[model samples]
Target chain A: MHPIAEPSLLLNTSICKANITKMAARIRGWQGDFRPHFKTHQSAKIGQWFRDAGVERITVSSFKMAHYFAQHGWKDITVALTCTPIHTAAINQLAATINLNILIEDVASIQALEDHLENPVGVFIKADTGYNRTGIDAEDFITLKKILAHLKDTKKLIFIGFLTHAGNTYHARNMAQIKKVVDPALEKMLALKTFLRKEFPLMELSWGDTPSCSIYNDFYGINEYRPGNFVFYDYTQVQIGSCSMNDVAVCMAAPVLATHPQRNEIVVHAGAIHLSKEYIQLPNGNISYGKVVKINHALEWDTHDIIGEVKSLSQEHGVISANKKIFAHIQPGDILGIIPVHSCLTAHLMKHFLTTEGNFIEMMK
Target chain B: MHPIAEPSLLLNTSICKANITKMAARIRGWQGDFRPHFKTHQSAKIGQWFRDAGVERITVSSFKMAHYFAQHGWKDITVALTCTPIHTAAINQLAATINLNILIEDVASIQALEDHLENPVGVFIKADTGYNRTGIDAEDFITLKKILAHLKDTKKLIFIGFLTHAGNTYHARNMAQIKKVVDPALEKMLALKTFLRKEFPLMELSWGDTPSCSIYNDFYGINEYRPGNFVFYDYTQVQIGSCSMNDVAVCMAAPVLATHPQRNEIVVHAGAIHLSKEYIQLPNGNISYGKVVKINHALEWDTHDIIGEVKSLSQEHGVISANKKIFAHIQPGDILGIIPVHSCLTAHLMKHFLTTEGNFIEMMK
Candidate 1:
């Protein structure tokens, strides 16, 4: 096996396929479109795995991401973030060929789309269920309906549906807490869907966040499932009761640079710029940047005998406060694999993946 | 001005040059090496700015960075992080030409260097004062002296000096607190130097953390200055009284994608992926992702009249809770500049930079 000299994201392709297979099985049963958000993986090779599992549609976070996947033969895709006129050229270019869908919350974006769109495209009105980050507040369906009416009256603008990202579920403490956050949002969406059906009965509805989408099985009414993070579950997802450590498919392989037995801290080359600055506070009130797991020569990891927790990180160093016995076992040149707190940010930071099979999977630039 | 389509790191060349000039003047007066750490602004263009100000020696955080600067004609360079055997090949490769200096605390690295060094290299024994991250503790001079003695006997290894990074100053509440952190650490370094000089009389002493190096001018005993983050002082530096907002050299130009008047929040295209997850808690105990600043079309920013505080961030979105009037005035397509809480991580995350002059500067990849 090649030494994990510096911090590089590693993928276990078998585990990733298993994760995809499990999610696909659950999502396929969801009486709706299963357009997994591509923003998490952002790899065309991973998209092929999805395609092999019968997924033809996807959701992405930006125009650049959408364009990358579109060029790779994904015909149906949604740029899940709100549309901006600055990306009009790329939007127009992509809309001319494929089934492109965009999110719009305010009337300004609709106006921009109307002004600059060279080709007609489907649109999802981003209605806020409760995240409060974006989308028109779902409670304000009156204004949303008026906008929908305006869109219906516009030429060639396909008013597809209402979409949302229930991001509040990310902060949930447990499955029940996740349900508490997600149920109300789903209720609000259903209420809006029923009301909007009066004018446009065929309009669809979509909502997703990894915790709510992965753990909660009753996603019956939603027209689309857009959860992205489940593909590469991280420590945060494990904490949220969405996935176990075994299900996580990606881990950052960092070279151990130095070890301090006095402090019981292991310094690794992986840090904020590699694993990202995202962290989850452990039950003991200490923050863990990522979960550290030791792997055998075959690159198979057994988290049962965990080495340490990455307690903190600077720009280029991850400080791990480990068990002294475990610390004694580590050498300076050894590679420590860290299960990142948030896989999406880690993937974004790494920009590429080296699978256990030694194939390099490129991320969308 | 070109419309700001997405988040791009904007560098104010004039302010940066002024910062370089000011710091260089301070170091020049000290009559010691002015090897400002290049890990902050990993751009060749910014390195050129340092060169324009008569900086010849440089400190980098990694071997790749050292090579990049070497390619740009920086001859005397130090890789400030602890040495690991995995990087032996690159270390030998770079040591063959440039005056490459490396940090080491343990004997394993010495053995590795002895095995692979194709050319002689300078070595600094890293000592720990209080950060507890790396380096042998200052009081552990017995171990340090043994290593130094070994290096003295070894061929191709020049034992130069003792170095310490008082990184705890990063958490200081203010300038006085920063001094409280630095003064003791410096005293400890001085004491170590006094004791070590009895045997190794020619050894140098160095200590640095941007807050201490930038604010406290008394560098009577330190032989080298290695402050990296002063080049782009950010909100953290301003809060700690190390530098003012006017001295801040870089800001992230993020496109306003949407707004929520009710929540008094504006959403932008920049998020953790762009600005990094570093943050500062506001005086009110609210965690802010970054400091938001309003800027004119000329790309000039007035930090005194602050725009807003980035209250929260996700993978691809930053939520700014600004003055209601400012929030009210913002259009969907407008751009807001954000002063990152920690400029080093922000710069590392950005990967490339776009100057206000519309030139693209590549980061050291």
Candidate 2:
């Protein structure tokens, strides 16, 4: 509802707060620590909403983000990615002021962290529970033992627990598929915890992925949850059965630049630079960049009134393929709300958000 | 490269200057105005490079960028995207000081601009040659005549020319295919120009697409050329045969965070945020977010020594699928250079550039 002239990220605060409240209550009901990932919104102002929901600990993707939130009073922080030794200075500075935790996968990284760290930091052995993107394979016990044995000699590094991001759930198309992808990943993490309990009896288990966290009620023995994207469930999450369209809190308000009635398409000011190039393959063998929704004069959108889909994008242009019913009502100066395929990337690209109540939320640059 | 602890954009200034010189000379050889699009780099310091090559006019995609460049002394500027009525205030302010031009495709937009204009501004009729993204179709003479007739009643709008961005050339896999996509688009533009000359004899023709401009020696009858990405050709351009690997002036210097020897992969700090999530599909049915190049002790990469390819990307992590040789040499502390798939999006994401010579070039935020 803000007076936006250009492509702007519109955040529905009520919906965002409800999402946080529901997730926080669910995690508390399961007796798990909810160190929700702050990488999705990257706004210190939005961090206050999580704090209102009784979340104190947080997870960030980068050292810079950790520092940003630390400056905003987030004391307990975890950097979820593998910590490279090149950021030794940043690690030492951040660890000196807060309860800093970093993920480590290989013995080499553990050794590198131990050699350069000037302050103590919690280390989580990143376990690969099927998302083969990064982290130590759950079945690779040799590397785990080596990392544990090497950490035994370290002065600054404190082994905390095992952590896994079942990112493969992002590829799931339905609730059953999501469960199929996550059940095995959780089993692997639990198995690894059991195997390592002989030497590391106090170790905790950390598992988080938006789909699995949103769908399942019980987390078995996992001690902590760190899902980020659930805060702003997008078109992709809706497609993956992680969350419903009603839970989506963020939408892009883009101005229509031109309309091509013959082609049944309208070009908007939003593009890859605004919404990100992430896309989903539709059932009709077409790729959709985002789903378009009608914006009322009050500048609010209804999730159920899905009008069209963004068929293509360039540097600063998004072409939405629309049907005659909706296309007839659209004009060059009209504004349309688009639910991005991936809200995390969209938030990152927009760098800020305008709440529906006309307040601007500043994010880390 | 410049003591980077995070993913950083690295610019080879020599290669960038060479790209500018070559493109300027070729445009001059064809007697066309070289208004290189500043949206690729969006840096005032880099704009100096174009000015040094005798380029006074420039093209940008947004009003914010047009204002930025105008402040930096760029007098002749064309906002290459369709102008919306919502930005009338910005348009009036910008056009009040500079020789500003905006693209218009329909009579509605022209009416909106005319009704809101407080200063004189040049207008170009956007013609959709083949991209089918925006603009009036070249064969849609009825609409063209209607727009021209409507513009005749305008007080502050000055008709400039017809402009077309043959973006279809981006999908071309080779130089021949590039020509195949551009030749007909050029013919359509020429035919439209000849027909429009009956009433608008002094109208100009502006055509721009990096692939077409870089591959073709002659831009017959086109009065102006505005190729933006040719300044920093990317992996997509190389695959499109617009330029060779040597022409790519920018590379992302990302810190290696973890190495998975069993999977022959390494995780880097460069991810979707750093690389813009633009990818090219390889012939082997694999998607490459970027091509990995070896960075020596001097932080210089040899185009011929491509070490691997970025197979997947998350928010802040890039998974490089490497061979045993490259995987064996990589460590958590090392820094690797990744040539991005699309330089424009990458440059936009990285707000500044660190030249190989260690100087930071600031861009418009």
DockQ of each: 0.75, 0.82
Model 1 C-alpha lDDT versus the unseen true structure = 0.85
lDDT of 2 by residue, A289-335 (tens): 99999877666788878778999889899999987777667888789
State the lDDT of candidate 2 residue by residue for B1-365, as single tens digits.
35779998999999999999999999999999998999999999999999999999999999989999999999999999787778788889999899999988877778888998999999998998988888888888888889999988898889988999999998899878888888889898899779878888989999888898897875688999999999999999999988999989999998998887777888899999999889999989899999999877666778888778999999999999987887667788789899999999999999999888888899998
User: What C-alpha lDDT, on a 0 to 100 scale, does residue B294 get in candidate 1?
Assistant: 82
Each model's C-alpha lDDT?
0.85, 0.90
> How do the candidates score on chain B by TM-score?
0.97, 0.98
Badly placed stretches (over 4 Å) of model 1 are none
lDDT for B10 (candidate 2): 90
- Residue A267's lDDT in candidate 2: 93
Predict model 2's lDDT versus the native. Answer: 0.90
Can you write out model 1's per-residue Cα lDDT over A1-365, one digit (the tens) per residue?
86666788989899889988888888777766788998899999999999999999999988888889988998998988787777677788889989999887777667777877888889898888889898888888678867886797666468888898999998887888988988889998998878877777897998878888788976657988888999889999999889989999998888888888777889999988888889998889999999888877766666776878998888889999888888668878888789999999999988999898877999987
Interface RMSD of each: 1.4, 1.3
Tell how far residue B232 is off in model 2, in angstroms: 0.8
